[model samples]
Target: MNQPKKMALIAANLAFFIIVGFFVYQRFGIYLNNPWTRDGQVRAQVIQVTPRVSGTVIEIAVVDNQHVKAGDLLFTIDASTYEVSVQQAIANLERERVSSKGAKIEYERLKDIAAKDAGAVSDKDMIRREVNYQQSLSRITVAEQNLIAAKLQLEYTHVYASVDGYVSNINFQIGSQAIANQPILALVDEHSFWVFGYFQESQLNKIGMGNAAVVTLMGYPDTPIEGRVESMGWGIAPADGTVGYNLLPSIKPVFQWIRLAQRMPVRIELEAIPDNINLRFGMSASVLILSEEDSP
Candidate 1:
């Protein structure tokens, strides 16, 4: 064939291949294979265990990675200073009560004398006595508050776990002064975890809620972790997601390349996790729908 005829033939063949490829892609091509996994680290609640009041840590009973129950004593702050404060507050409270009692007795005696007309107790004197009694009562209230604060400070010397879980990294040690709102440690819950899988928008019709999933994790190697798709998200993960970061732009020039499909996260819940297995969080896994043909 001449050059023009050869060129025409090549063009025709290219068109034919393109049409065939498009038809096949429309019918059977896997638009999204984004295999997802669910074997994540058993998450524990990171509890900020800090003193209600600032104090020196006198004793630390627990270490890192230690298992503890709810209400278990984690450590103790020195209570001697707090105990002294309590004693001083109690003394002040008692002094106020005694003074109020003395005032009451004196006022009662003066009133009796004035009524009998045996003593010249002026109206001003009576007012003074009443005022003194009220003042004493107010002092007693203040003393009571001081005593309560002292006792509460004393109780704060001891720290306890709020929930049952593993003891993570402990931040404070003996002699370390912990202020209010400071983080002491964390507690990881071991009961279970949920997997976050990112799927393309086009795959939404095939993989859906309650669809069976096969998770092939690295920990077990050949052992497959069976699970099911719990649910799909109603919203799309933004180009800039909940986090401040977004995926970098593609390397192609402005118009030459096709736009990549966006992926939405799907939550996969494990049907059952064998207790003896050592599956962990952040471990990469290949996910596949347990379907012969992709169906809704």
Candidate 2:
């Protein structure tokens, strides 16, 4: 309405526009200088918890999603059978030891007689006694090995956590039959957390090993995680010519005029995480890899 007020209003509008323009320019520059992708996921080492010895699960020391430390007991299989096996092995070993001692004594006695009087003990008899002693010694070794194996199997019945991690996907319960070498649950290694960013081929040139990276998880947008580029995938499975029905090559139809750039996984190793933040497997993330010159 007034001249002075009009000038003040115009000045205020110009200042606001300039500030907005500067902010936009700065963000655009950051994007142009860095490679970013929304196709990112949180990853970690998932260890399959498998039992070396099969038996009924008599006790479960941990529940699903429980945090565990290395050497912590996970579950207990019915160790009664293994205990019996160990006892049997010990008895067999004792028997072998006794037989070996007797054989050795017999062989030594024959050897002493033969040395004193060659005609009293035949050469064939001495040879037979020596062979029997040697065979008995061999049997003792075999029994020792069997005992060791039995003890190992018995130890295996008490499953322990192999690493510091979180137990996951525990589908079995007490009294559940566990088969040898079959995974009963999964353990997500807490210290092995990393990010896998699927970046377009065109952006590969901007990414390099040890490059600084920023990851914004979908679940925790306010807290950004710092990381570095560890490695890049060398290849991806081709979707074009895979074996399909009728034993023929199945080729995907693509537009002749448009070609989609293939995405390759770039692994990012996360830095020290904040105590407040929790990293989980398969969480969606947004990744930004900074240029070498811009990295701190």
Candidate 3:
């Protein structure tokens, strides 16, 4: 090889290196500015199933992981006690009604006698009769309220699904004692399912509400789910500025050399979820906001 040939070879290698470096820089910039995030999770509204009235579980209408519709029976509590309460309420209401009727009749008679002759009924006696009638009316109202409450308690004995969802975390079975307002199971709402994507705050400018997105679930990687950006989360728990036990705002020390961009959750509303693909709450997902040209 001659000296000129060696110089020519060096020049060629230099040009190749420069071109490669330029392409690499462009690719890195694209990766950084891309409106996408691997830090996304499938989310849904979880309905905690709790009974308003407590009793022994008599029957379990649905099993664990069962799909149920709104108003479907989930389980039944022993309603014997509630039924007795209803009967007692009804009897009390009847007694109050009878007493109120008698008081009304007596008050009317007293008023009529007083009207015929002022001296026939004493003012004190007439006032007393009116008081009695008012008290009876008040008692009747109380009894009616008690009856409604009893009926409400009876209705609580039959637990029903509040939303269309899959039953999860079912711990109570037949014969298990359920406490009032205590959660026995959770229903993950199917229709309320959405993906929460945490993107770098710096990349949020490219993401707008209603922007089309493509989601790939970890479970169903081959099937891309279509969605739209619903909204951006306005707030997140602060990592550094929390109140300390000493009652002062605790600001965490930061390293001046390295700064990390905060992640903001972007809500993605799924378009048409495929029937074949099942979406589970808290499932891992990857989401990408499509550029206008890429969106179908």
Candidate 4:
């Protein structure tokens, strides 16, 4: 063929391939930008067991990594002190009741004597009886409050689990002193688990709230957990420190550095989380967000 004819044939083939490529891209081409897989830590609900009242530990029931149900026995403080307080409260309450009853009887006697026109119980005596009755009523109220407080202290002696979860690392032992606000141990909820994925800021446009993503874990990589975007966090890292809280880079490049993308953690709630496997906190996971668009 002539030189011009061969050149024309080659050009024609290139044009045809370009057209086909464009058509294919329109149908299935997706633009993905700045692909990275940072390590993801598994998050779980942690229960911090703390003492409500100051006491001496008498019974340490559960051990480290022990599973417990709601209202299960966790420990017991010495109830001897609380039991003595309860007895005192009960005695005071009984005394108040008897005094109140006696006041009522005295008031009734005064009423009868005054009605019979006897000076043995004068008007002053009736007035005194009325005052005593009111005083006795107030005493009874105070005794009732004391009784309630004593009963509450007794209940605090027996510690029970507030949540159903697997236990870990019991800090207290029998004969040890435990005070209020002390963290006895921590329990990670095996039933509740989710993943938090940090995606680049560039991917934000394509990924909307409710987009489906496939989650694979280092623990169970074969089992892909399907999840959807539950909600986008409002507090994104600031851009330029003016739009939000953006961290200023510590080191600046002298070679006219290009702008780098920032990553935001997107909380993903699994569409269905099965209770088959224990998903503890700080486990590694990888998620690939299924997107129709390549680069946002």
Compare the candidates by TM-score and give the number of the best one.
Answer: 2
RMSD, candidate 1, Å: 12.4
Evaluation by TM-score, superior candidate among 1 and 3: 3
Residue-by-residue lDDT tens digits, candidate 1, 1-296: 89999999999999999999998886444434434334232222356676786778888888987878888898887788889999999999999999999999988888998998955898889889989988999999999999999999899888888777777778667899877667777666544455566666776676767777766665676776677888777897355323333654434244546767777767767767765565444566666654445533
In the range 191-252, model 3's lDDT, one tens digit per residue, is 89999999989989888778899899999999989999999999888898788878898887
Name the weakest run of 10 consecutive residues (lDDT summed) in model 2: 270-279
The TM-score of candidate 3 is 0.83
| Candidate 2 Cα misplacement greater than 4 A, ranges | 1-24
Give the 10-residue window scoring lowest on summed lDDT in candidate 4: 27-36
Worst 10 residues of 1 by lDDT: 36-45
Regions more than 4 Å wrong, model 4: 1-39, 118-128, 236-260, 274-276, 291-296
**Model 3: which residue pairs collide?**
none
Candidate 2's displacement at residue 30, Å, is: 1.0
Report, for every candidate in turn, its global Cα lDDT versus the true structure: 0.72, 0.95, 0.92, 0.77
Q: Order the candidates by TM-score, highest first.
A: 2, 3, 4, 1
Report the Cα lDDT for candidate 4: 0.77
Please give, for residues 19-77, the per-residue lDDT of candidate 2 as tens digits: 99999998788888899999999999999999999999999999899999999999999
lDDT at position 209, candidate 4: 72
- Model 2 residue 204 CA deviation (Å) reads 0.6
Which residue pairs overlap in candidate 1's backbone?
40-281, 41-281, 44-188, 44-189
* lDDT of the structure predicted as candidate 2: 0.95
**Candidate 4, residue 239: CA error in Å?**
13
